[model samples]
Target: KDSAEVTIKLKNNRRETVASITETIAPKDVLISKKGSHPTPYDVIHKAADTSNCINIAFLAEGYTETEMEKYINDVKTATDAIFAHEPFLEYKDRFNVIAVKSVSEESGTSVPSKGIWKNTALGSNFDTFHSERYLTTLNLKKVHDWLAGTPYEHIIILVNTDVYGGGGILNYYNLSSTGHKSFKPVIVHEFGHSFAGLADEYAYDWEEIPMYPLDVEPWEANITTLADFKGKWESLIKKGTPIPTPETKDEKKAKNKVGYFEGAGYRTKGVYRGVQDCRMRTNACKEFCIVCKNALTKLIKFYTGE
Candidate 1:
């Protein structure tokens, strides 16, 4: 069935009906599982009642062989624990349902183009994305959706089986990361900040001499800003009397926790400004999302959960 009648309702905390509307919605087309099809197995890592009111996240295996499916589920649990370890997610844990999709690969590891290694993975995910050695991603999005057909998933998290340190995320699309990397926890959460809340990278490569944002126009991301429209971003969140271009703290720890308009984000050092000296979006150094990012994520969660 490609089209169906869906009723979207808004309810109050008291369970009172606030508003309701029904509309015709068409879902994306994909091959449904049949008796002859080798349907992939899935586990409900976290389940919620009335899934219509909850956010569903799918953790799909990218390079795990059939024998490694157990390890894949373990990875999903680890990643889930990492997510709820932070603020907002921990506070709103009941608003989510997590699933682990075990899509076996003929081989056990993803491709590393820089290393001239390729595997016949389920999704054909690989490193060296866009010439960046650490940017792991997949171009075969169709296969990903096909594998996830009939799953109650709104967000996609592809767990690639490799110890390589790399991952990437696109806004509202999906987040992919290496499950075996030491930085897996932080990398997945950082990528989630992108795919879940449309957050931008709060880091830059000044040495590259290429700007990702225009100084004359503000970037639409909730965290970083071009100062062209500072008020449209976290400008109001900056403490009174704080410097516009916030100065770095002498101590790295203090800097990571501080919230201010720190210039250096979106792959450019000068023009773009971020909400903190350092953030989960910036590096794996910080253990959690910065205040500005937390606020944005909180807002998004509330929107999703109708809170």
Candidate 2:
């Protein structure tokens, strides 16, 4: 992976700054240096009469070529349908504008460093981010924004053309996934949970005990918790007598369906906790968002749509 040396700086409102050279390295920024896609033909897949009141979502192509642009549009339709079939988004379908932007790529697939596979994709997306083989992501945020500069978009969803199971998202950033994967629908929705509603991953891995959430400090995400500020989270929704650090039970009606402070989240086996025994944020097996996630999602939707 041929990466370049780059520097970044942060500043306060008064313009006072702390200067430091952070070694931000990655695969060469191919997408940014590439020529722009002008006369960018697009279709408003879902249109609302009141643009000001509705959320704008654009589906852009990542690893598609000019010949595959039509197919990309169809893929966009599939993604739109997938998200709309679920809760919250389903209930408030009309309050959104879905646009399909045809940004053709020089090559037709993403890079997988572990597999020694690389291609000149539109967004420069690839697998093996942070040495996590399936963790697909693109650091070309500026290029992404540049591509959608003229489009009416408040949210972004970049569909990569691949069958490998990979996708990633960040809050208020973008949702990305592989359209060719079997878990396409669920993966996109799960990543959307991160990008749109600021939801955290409920799943945990004992192998990697990264202190992403300090036990003394509460997480700002709506789903997971550190218990330092438990009252600020979904405390109102928890029924009285429900045990804290809720134990996972064999009873489907009690454990899986109920909202309790289940330990193990944010990639840690301990110190972190999620609001439910199981949820879509936790696993693809649980198709629906848990009560807490749904509530947080609904609040965000209402705030945007004024519903």
Candidate 3:
């Protein structure tokens, strides 16, 4: 195992602060770091996206008591191990390291801090925190940047022990705050798929925000597409009749009904298209990742492990 230290810079209308983040590249086991702050109720870390050396996954954990501490550690281990067990990750076992950070919280609080699969009201709304949550108080991005600068991690994954739902985003970072109601092991894996894998939401519904991706522009995601440049990813996987905009019909009798343009996706409709009407990215069914996602993940693993 090897480690590096880096500094992150955070600036705003008020002032600029720097925090140091340490990254330890590991091949086989999980790497743990000291809690950056006391009474720290949350955890954060980075993962290797497409980088050199062995570090593949990074995480941060937070605990307030011995019992919670033990459970948090064990839960993170299980989630990280399970992630690598799947395709792509399984294919690059030697290079994956899910890094974690342990933070403490006030003993009186009923729930610890960890993000959930989605809609973490406990964390105070969704993206709002990203804008309103004080930089140094919650996540000192400058420090996090410094921490990651020391390692070869290109992608980042964060873990939290509370029972509430956890969530992850793109370069913006993900949150998996705890609900303190049930075991969040499964949610950990699901959310990581989004945070670490660049996985898109597969399910569909309505949202206040209109279409996010431009249908004509085509999507960079391996799984979904606007058919603008399908050749790179799912073009080959699409069945002969698979329409440009995959269908959502479950009835086999309507197999023909399966291949047609459908609406609703990527938090919007009209333009963005998805490979299938439903997938693990969009729902909680635990569906296998679409071929494009699988291959992308596989490539990511190879990029890190050289396996």
Candidate 4:
């Protein structure tokens, strides 16, 4: 009936900080059969296995200056609407609820403080101006937990308005936004791909930070793995000639005809895995999710909706 708190130690210093975030069951009164419902915070219900409900998405605008508040809200709402309007999720439109929160724009992360608090960088550019550390630190997990647990939603989606290129994620922690003049719509979808569906980034690149999952083992997720034990997950979707390393191409024909391992995926160089080498989850191109990500999301949708 309430939310839970999580404490994490910083990878750099092993300093412990508590994160406050909430995770509660979706309230019974919030379900609607029609569109334009403006679902309330209390309307977000948590049914991990209920096919009638999807994850509750919450948007947080940490504004140090009042100047950007209104614009922030509108931009984020538009971005979110556009995102869910795509694929498998659009079919279950009524099942998800979205909410927005306004919080103090606290300064976070000494290394990249401008983006406030975040764990990693995605579209690295503006190092400071729009920075809001919505991700890196765990000092507010307790409050976040309380807010989510007290609400009707099971998961919380956070969109930070700082123009920095930082964002973070966990089993249910909020997703950070990239700050700048350009449209961040694609990044919003990309971050959600990580936060909501447990989807891993398929692009390979160097990063100062390491990933949470090991590449050598069969991943616990239903999609994206090193195929160490391919049969454990995603193997059924593999078609013959679909190599272990998938190539990055815009070939729609290839997307339809094969399921192969693409190179430069899973955020690391060594692991051979499956996924469209180019997807929103893998790049800033705002492309559709790979079939692998879709299948995983479909399972999550079914889990929440109880369908």
Q: Write the per-residue lDDT of candidate 2 for residues 114-155, one digit (tens) a residue.
A: 989988987899999999988998998887877787778888
Off by over 4 Å in 3: 1-52, 63-67, 105-139, 143-155, 171-183, 207-209, 251-263
Root mean square deviation (Cα) for candidate 4: 9.2
Residue ranges of candidate 1 with Cα displaced over 4 Å: 1-39, 251-257
What are the per-residue Cα lDDT tens digits for candidate 1 across 123-144?
Answer: 9999888898888999998899
Q: Which ten residues in a row have the lowest lDDT in candidate 3?
A: 119-128
TM-score, ranked from best to worst: 2, 1, 4, 3
lDDT (0 to 1) per candidate = 0.86, 0.85, 0.49, 0.55
Worst 10 residues of 1 by lDDT: 29-38
Cα lDDT for residue 124, model 4?
A: 25
Clashes in predicted model 3:
53
| Higher-lDDT candidate of 1 and 4 | 1
lDDT tens digits by residue: candidate 4, 1-307: 2333444443321223444444444334356223223432332122223343455676654432245556656756676675776777676666776655443343321235553544331112123433443343334554555434334445555555456455555556556555443546777677777777777766666762345446656666555677667774656666777655656566766654456676555556766465555566766764577677777888887787676
Please rank every candidate by lDDT, starting with the best: 1, 2, 4, 3
The residue ranges of model 2 lying beyond 4 angstroms of the native Cα positions read 1-39
